[model samples]
Target: MASRKRPALARLTNALATPSQLQVSQALGLSGSLLSSLHYLGGSLIQVAGAILNIPAPTIATSAIIFHRFHLVAGFLEQSIRDTVAACLYIASKSCEFPLRPSVILAAVDTACQDPLAVGGKRIPKRKYTRANTETLDHWELRILTTLAFNLHVVTPYTLCMEYLVSANVDRDRQKTVAQRAWNYLNDTLKTKICILHQPNVIAVTAIWLAAREAELELLDGEKWWEAFDVDTEDMGHLVLLLREGRDIAIRERDRIESGRKPTLTVEDVKARILEEASLSSRQ
Candidate 1:
């Protein structure tokens, strides 16, 4: 018999993928809840790592996007998610023109990993940066590069969002409120798959839409401002709903932590739970 051939990989892009193009985790029979938890965990790690490294927000956002895209192509089970998080930050920092040394990136990741709140209240022991650790990160960095096919140019929603706000010409008094809310919405979307699903322009418009409604500020003299941007009304509505769901998840996670519950699921915790559940199911 002729040797079996592997399935063709999906063409990678900065945004958009068809529903038929299942993520690697989905292909592995992972539950939706487990995948969501992992996505949130990775994003949180990127945020904390960025803060510890004093990297800029744009670079942090790019890192989160790269992290998600990498997992979408190569499942969390295939690679160490924590190490990938550090590697993504390292690659994004360079791509975003905010380069940091690998040693510095590793240090920041170590500190971020030690945060109990970020890691679902688990006390992760700090690991010293040995030659082995450096080699591991270098390997992950190359994996990300090849998995993503060197598509590192990520266009974020922040600049588009600011432009839309300026074009809308909101009242000077409420301008800051609207801008801040819109920015927060953009950041929250990073935690979910919304970033990969919609184009940056669409996401930016939707963010402004929600922010204006909350501030009770009308844009473009109460006309259909989104129409001017050529944004579909239906897409805006869909993004709004997605953003709401992400916000709810964030709030619940926060409350759970504050209430002193067992803490939200970390990537490692979720992986272990999934394996245990699979074992139990197999026995049954």
Candidate 2:
């Protein structure tokens, strides 16, 4: 079973971003902080849009993963992030067999794009679903499809994580708590680049590891529990560290924003900036 799975894992490595590939956004003039904010914004948009459409969690996760992969290959400058979110959710909804109509997706995304805390606390205007808007979405959908080579078979860790929890030797009473925490960890990881950095199974194991440790619950084999799933100890440890770092960064950003030390950038602000930059470039 492990040997057979190795080939799929090997293929997934192709999707992983190399160091130079990670620098694509930076090269495109996005600072490290801004890049992280963009990632957070994309994930938030996916979650909110999915909720509005009543999409399932797995499909929502797939959408966020698609968004991350798209940005890695084609930097944020190449496409409007809001449009890409709509396109990715549409693609993932179909790929996950929970198809939504393009019009429905556009409505949900348009609603999700509004920011109530914009300049002077005014609500950002929601985009109308005009013919031109539909064309823009169609263009973005094609771009995402072509950029990802139409390979939308995303393998998320939700199922495997749940399966591992069922197999774990935790007490019945504490099982729910551990599972919920692990699931939350998995969701949190989606906000960061860790999803693209590690394989699904590795991520599942890391979440389980973190949850179990927090609950003071040991698995069947204790120290070697992950071996049953063919996970490397070092990789799991590294993932745990990455997860913590991602969480810490998020907390710091939240604190900074709350303290009014940093102003929050709305979708409208980003779109306007991108358009202004493009106009300047075209004139040059």
TM-score of each: 0.86, 0.81
lDDT of 2 at 181: 92
Residues 137-256, candidate 2, lDDT per residue (tens digit)?
789989998987887767788888988888886777788999999998998777667777777888898898899899988889667888887789888887877667666656765676
For every candidate in turn, the CA RMSD to the true structure comes to 6.4, 5.3
TM-score of 1: 0.86
Model 1 is weakest, by summed lDDT over 10 consecutive residues, at 1-10
Candidate 1 off by > 4 Å: 1-13, 116-127, 277-284
With a 3 Å backbone cut-off (N, CA, C), the pairs that clash in candidate 1 are none
